[model samples]
Target: MGRPLIHRSPMPGLGLSMGITLTMLSLVVLLPIGALLLKGANYGLAGMWDTVNRPRVWAALYLSFRLSLFAALFN
Candidate 1:
């Protein structure tokens, strides 16, 4: 006969592992993005456009793009 589908095996502590993983994912990944989105929502489209159009922002973006491209090429 085939084995039962939902039988528990030898593994343990899965819930603890999942909880820690989800907590870290929220803190490390989700929180900063949420904060950035909230800040942008408060700033509104016109303010964001003004900030994006500035020379300093353009230079920084260009530098970031170049660095990313360089790293991608090496990879």
Candidate 2:
């Protein structure tokens, strides 16, 4: 034979699929994180740290971690 036959997938190729996946992930995940960082920068580092260090924030964070741990173990 002069040349061998090449096989093709029924679905869209890897490049197109990866591009869509990355675009969706950037919109859904990265944008919010970027906005949070931008807000923190505008707030000033000291103010952001003070806000995070408050008793209410500490308690909420602790509770969330505890609940997450319990849920993970239970599941």
Model 2, runs deviating above 4 Å = 2-24
Each candidate structure's count of clashing pairs: 0, 0
Q: Write the per-residue lDDT of candidate 2 for residues 2-46, one digit (tens) a residue.
A: 888778777758889889999999999999999989999988999
**lDDT string, candidate 1, 1-75, tens digits:** 997798775668888898999999999999999998899988899988898899999999999999999999999
lDDT of 2: 0.94
User: Alpha carbon lDDT of residue 26, candidate 1?
Assistant: 100
What is the TM-score of each predicted model, taking all chains together? 0.61, 0.65
Q: CA shift at 51, candidate 2, in angstroms?
A: 0.8
- In candidate 1, how many Å is residue 63 off? 0.6
- Residue range with the least summed lDDT across 10 consecutive positions in model 2: 5-14
